[model samples]
Target chain A: MKHSIHMHSLFEKLNLEDIQVEDNSTLYGQANIERIRKLTLDKVRKDRKEMSFSFKRQLCKVALVACAVLCIGGATVFAAANEGVRETISSLLGISQEKILKVGESIKNKDYKLTVLELACDSYTGIATISVEALSPKAQETFFKDNIVHKLRISPVGYGLREEAPDEYRRYFSFSFKVSKELNLYPEEGLTFSMEGISKKITIPITQTVELTELDIDIPASEGYPMSYQKLYYSDLGFTLLGSLENEDVNSENCLITIEFMDGSISKFYHYYRALEQVKSDNRISVAKTQASIGRSERSVKNDTAPSDEDTIIDFDTEWFSGGSNSINSGKVISIFSFSKEMDWSTVKSIMVNGTTVRLH
Target chain B: MEDYIIIKRLKQNKEKALEYLIERYSSYVVSIAARIGGRLLSIQDVEEIASDVFYAIWKNRGNLIETGSLKPYIAQIARNMTKTRLCHKREEEPLDEDMLVFSSEGVDELIIHKEQLQFLRDTISLLNYPDKDILLSYYFWNYKLTEIAERFDLPLSTIKSKLYRGRSELVKRFEEGGYYYEA
Candidate 1:
């Protein structure tokens, strides 16, 4: 599927207009354009702040947790040790002992597996490092297996920790995991390390800008409109479009169109239309008192056999509301009650809510 | 009769508001569905989704933080609705919130890139003659820092500084124009 899409795009790049013509099949016609526009406009109105308060609160909570943990455990350990040991541990940890102490204080009796690995700091210094490692429930089995040890190499003096720490603050440590399987990893953007227990959730906003090129769909000869292809032409307001196939016997409606010609532009017909002379001047298409089957392309069900007993009537009621002063003055207050009902099943037909009626099937 | 007044009416559960909303945004919804190439849902389906969005907004109008940022807010809602419609069509796949994460990982990158390009095009069209020329020469025309300085008859450092500030200003404009910050 991906390969075909790539090929489709390649063909598109070779000819964009043509490619777009081919692309039109993927999009539904212009029927729901107003709805999409409204929804989009509403979205812009909802979230004014780039980052909401909840997000900030969540970040703060994580920070507080880390601080509490570090203070409870990490501070005591550093305070008990000598200055040299403290310096050594700090170098191995890469972060200031204060930060570690903050994290340790928050952790209360939680079983934590600690790993101490001799590694090189970022400044090429050899350092002893202590870090937390979580062997997820699913990976514990394989991780404990007797796997081949790759190599044991450490930095000379100021190890990988020195890389993150500036030359002035050369005392730091670093540790890394060596996984056997491929892993999808995303480090904190512009930085490698993140605060402990902080969750990173990404939200993407959808955006789009489009220019409507052209509409050239052929309206088929249906019962409603019987206009010949050549006789129907458009002049700015409306027109009829037609299509032909090599096999004239094939169903024209179902035939897939190839909207490509010269200049790398491709055009496809959305639907056939027969514009009435009266409404052509308005450049608008509307259906009034029209009984149109939505999914008509499907196979028809033949009901030659007569039904024995069928009750089509659905019990319904009417709900009404008075229009405003202006609407009442305009003589538009009266709206008919269509359907308000209770049924054994969930289907409701015509529903009159307030003053408007919705046709539901 | 104004759009905002209509929105207020919708919030008040006035039936006329529904008609007004449908009349106003139905075409826009269809256009959005068309752009995304939503094959599972028809234009009518898009209308239903848009209707739901409006209904939700109406129900939660009091809770909305920024009423003025309507366009981007509605854009995000429509986008979410589009995803929901697409996901529901895949009945065999177990419904997982994480599926949205998977869909967003790579596909959104393309969308963001397209938006940025569009924003840049708009910015180019909107900038003044001198600023536009400087931007076009430095960025679009790919003129070297020294070359831009030489062409504009300014110091190389000045040219670079202006370019930097111009880029930053353009970013701020894009942000204001609803190009959301990802991080």
Candidate 2:
């Protein structure tokens, strides 16, 4: 079936009021507004830093894994979809988020056959649930039994199918890669989906961005509430964020987001990362909650501990924590929760812990 | 003005075209970045991705300009850049773990993502600004519902209910064939 999206393009989907086009300085109250020249210069500065002979280069191929307990549909589930595609993706339409395609539609190529059972298409990622069967018994035995599958790589480099894990049966496989390379959300013609040597491609006629309710929150401010979206819209009372970890390793995935769209300026952003698996309720010396914003701390890097006002870090530690291969029991979850960003302290009307909401106003 | 004219200006003068595009679509870029891998990236990283996306589009002005629309191109570029950024992050600073679990591919659980993005897109387009922005950021950019509710100073209960209502409304619209732009 052809998909017919309502917009001429993805840009048409954005609300006009959200478009802030005044000069960065006037809008953001920044002392200096950067011109394209300075932005270009920053690019030059980066290249120079990279080429400097004294700078040591490191390609840290850390095997970062996000072991999520509590099935809160963890944030990293889709981003770090290194698990069986089945485990991470569910039906967008069904309550269980079931698959869109089925295995009944299988296609074959010479000595082997391929079937695409599921297709997960977002603006950036297109994941296919595939089933492969060898025509010859010998080939099937070698490919499945000995796990001599690495030799047969998927094609076309970046757009090619990656050798993820198979389903319960040895025949099923899943692959996900970038599809927005040609994501003309509103092309003169609609978009299409197809894969070579895998399945027939079809033009997706429609694409819609899901609508959540508009928040009618206005943090009453005397200092004329900061213009930043977060500060203006949500930052009222100070609160903490807690998370459960799949592993206890020095995961560099932890990040802090701070920038002023009004001024088009960036401030000092501190990057901190740590993964905790062993230090849960059993060892964290906590009673009920595995993690709460009040008691969360950094379990890695002790040397240079500098806290900034942009965000808060309450009761933090310096020891690095990591996890083991065995998935921690869901019952006894080993969490690596840390403090996320803090609001304006005064603007918060409510505090959210996990899914539970508390009125703080 | 047509996309080509704007692009022509870009080709002749880099700064002016960039200024225009940036003024027009910076929020759009951030929205998409958040949808794709915004949670993993800092705002600076998102900015870097936006800058690079514009630069790439400018460099390939010939192909895109003729298309007469920069919206889809921008969206596509934003997505590609985010994907690239995520891939790079996975390679360089992916969450550090002692053990790596290989992804499992399944056959029985195979089903289309049910074209959910399409219906959601149309429903969102009908929303006013902040509402549309909130949903886009939450779903496409992976922002937490609670975070979004907090951002808007709304209760988490309110946000979840609205999302539920909006989603239900969208499915109803689809069932009724109400929001089809192509027809």
Candidate 3:
């Protein structure tokens, strides 16, 4: 009664030529294809038009907001100048324009000038926007053309630039660094931003930190994976789950977090490793072993363990849109769940993890 | 119609190219989706999945390689979509028994490794004519036993026996290769 999960995985990896089959066109008539074609073409056209319209509308909105901020004639004027930075901070951090900390810090060389425009940080995550402007035309031609900005590094947590930027602010780039308390990577003092070929470095201090509501509650272990909860820190942006697992085979990916709001709304976050490709390529044997161990653990749980009548096991039907980062060090696992949209943490009634619920209120 | 020509037309944003693609691969997509979905999904569900697969193809036309055959890409999409649909359906209802096949007697014996998967692939390739074809049709394409029987013009019992024998051969090969051990 062994599961065919591995078999399915094996089959998927097979060469296309090996599994080639004759076209059974009789199963689906010509009428079916025609209908599919029409529907697909209509969708493509609609998507294209909508994308165009959306881009134009967003540009207009951002432009208006930028102009409005400039007209106000205050600290916001700096943010208005770097609209790309301001927009990214607003979107990613789920914060208002006023809450965005304006860091008018700059470090320059003969070739280029790098300016730190804005930054937002909490207990776990930090996002900063930096503008790399070429000082000379030659620098612009050689450096910008080659896209050498990726050579820039922010120590401890790596930085990723925002791919899509308005044409007007093509030089503006946003770098985000996330630090987890459980991992002991929290930059209590500041972050060091440096670039290759440049001797000078800029130290952007963590001046302002967003207030996070902390909840300390002990949740009983689920039948499948034996885990103990320690703390839950949540804000308007997202939430973090700090727990310890007795079984190392119980991957954080299987730990589904569902937040039930006071208003009867629910938000689910599925924990997935961001470096999954790296794990598969670099540690294939380890991954296979982990999978096998997980299978064994699941089998034992099913055969030996029994849940009490009060215990309810929730099976999530919907595909989770929000992503969570999981890191396990010495049996202690930290799962940071990021929300797709801004949430009112006060309105949350209870948080459930793998069917075990802990009331917050 | 050739896959390259169809890919070229798709890249050019020609709607008729999509029609050609749908006409050529609709049956193939439907077959994959139907086989994967099995009794869990209705005819309409399978049809919807087929449409979605085509739509995905059209959407990713720019990324499609003009030289390579589109069958693999289409097959992958069909499998993915059908599996995703099944997962969502499983959330709404009780777990599908076929999907949640547990190991007997709580023994943690069978472990599939990357090397073993490669060995399985090699073994599958070396299989004799109709056996190889039947195995691919049954496992890779996820064709039903009855469907394989009909396609091969063989009896259902013969098809089943062939599949069982093929699997046993795979196990034996794996054991000899030191990739698998019987419990």
Candidate 4:
């Protein structure tokens, strides 16, 4: 092709500004005044008809609300208590007051609110358990003795995993009272609780924020090999447990980055969910490391000097096929710390263990 | 509410239907009419021509379809009205024939092409914040390599590399987000 000739001809083909602007003047209105009322807007909207999936899907909104209400007030709570010993305690005792339960008396009543607020639950082998950090109304002190949180039952709702429990659905619930009226309330204290007959128990402990250090990871031949990859350096590994009510893409499509905290909680940061409509989603991004690992910070990995020693490593193993197109060589490991694209030296978090996968909570 | 519906109820009347129709698509009709008018005539003259086009559509609504399409139907009305307005205003003098070549490129085809472009615009608004900004600034805004470098505060080469890689990233994300279609 004649490079200059082609360029000149292309330039003559169309005015780039006119092509860019097209007839999209309505989007950026002219310097004029106009007022549209509700009826006028609705009429115009109906005239310019278009199909919307979100609105169609929203037809099921009423059904979902009804399900939510029924699941909250039913026998689901008892299911947790009978399912396992750990769940039995967590259902009734509340984390901080786990061990402080008497036969019939409730020890830390004020702390119950805190425990409920911070409730975290996990289930294994059809049994569910919950624990939360609780503080007594009084300062540091131990006043309660070994007591039991009786009548433990958990009501398990078919929350996200509706397909998992087709045979039977169950939830959990628990309630406990001191054996005699002589037992009075202590202002501040700590304790653990378990179900009446089940071994499932929950104990709330003092919560504290701890610094994260590098956990070196060696890619076994088991996953794949890297062709050519770059390294990224990050500063601080700001870690937090994935809570239910937070800004997250836990259920986004093809999000391979899952962060597991030391406290048995899990969260995923799928970057593909952040792209625009014209972009294709790359499935090669592996989120299979289902175990608890450090989540890379989006802000810390800017293109500058490395921030600090607290940074975490995200080892992206981009193994290209031998016949793959472009410079993407098959079998390449490009490790990035945080969101930086430049290659840098680093490793994974220390909290992650080998041979065992840390699943997200 | 019923008055709005009453227009639809009286779709059989030629003049009444045309009046309601003009009131209905006035904004879109005016804007598109303005675009064509601005290029061919003065702004004030175009505005007058656009209003006249609306009046013509108002007088001619009985001939229009009830719902299948609105744009193509109105575009035809605008074109005819514009030709009439131009002939009366420019009867004594004529413009260069070459300028008319630009106008000859079927405005109707352009109108149809605009529907697809509007669909693309709607799709962009549905994207997440970061992805939407990056794609719009790079493509629609058309900042050059050095300009982007200064704006994003990065090395020129880094900006180039990022633009190359970011385009690919966006392509992948767009497909994954179910926006892009395989050829």
Cα RMSD, each candidate: 33.8, 28.6, 23.5, 28.5
* Window of ten residues with lowest summed lDDT in model 1 chain A: A75-84
How does each model score on lDDT?
0.30, 0.35, 0.53, 0.28
Better-scoring candidate (TM-score), 2 or 3: 3
- For model 1, what TM-score is found for chain B? 0.41
Q: DockQ, per-model, please?
A: 0.05, 0.02, 0.12, 0.02
Candidate 3 per-residue lDDT over residues A1-361, each given as its tens digit: 3434345456667755445333332343333655666666667656644433333333323323433422221100000001112245665434665656788787777776777778766666455777776777777666545544445545434222343343432366654445665666555656666665677778877644566767665644554444566676765445666777665443333444555678796754332121223433542111000000000111112221223332223232111122234455666755554433345566767666655566665
Taking chain A of model 2 alone, its TM-score versus the true chain A equals 0.30
Sort by lDDT, top down from the best: 3, 2, 1, 4
Q: Give the poorly placed runs of model 3, Cα more than 4 Å off.
A: A1-88, A91-94, A142-149, A158-161, A167-169, A180-182, A220-227, A252-254, A262-265, A271-324, B1-183
The better candidate by DockQ, 2 or 4, is 4
lDDT of 1 at B180: 36
Q: Write the per-residue lDDT of candidate 4 for residues A264-295, one digit (tens) a residue.
A: 43333211122212123432221211122332
Residues forming the 10-long window of minimal summed lDDT in candidate 2 chain A: A318-327
Strongest candidate by DockQ: 3
Question: How displaced is residue A139 in candidate 3, in Å?
Answer: 4.2
Candidate 1 lDDT over A1-361, as tens digits, reads: 0101111122122211111111133444545555544564454334312212222333223223322432221110000000111123333222333322212111111222333323221111112343333334433434323110111121111111111221221222232211000111112121122222323312111111111112222223222222112111111111112222222232121111111223343222111222233334443212110011111122223221111142111111011100000001111111000000001111223221111122223
Per-residue lDDT of model 1, residues B72-180, tens digit only: 5666666666545533221132212111111122246566555545655555556653455555444433345565566556887776666665555555655675543
Instruction: Please give, for residues B78-161, the per-residue lDDT of candidate 4 as tens digits.
Output: 666654553321122211111101112223655534433443344444554334333343443433445445544668676555
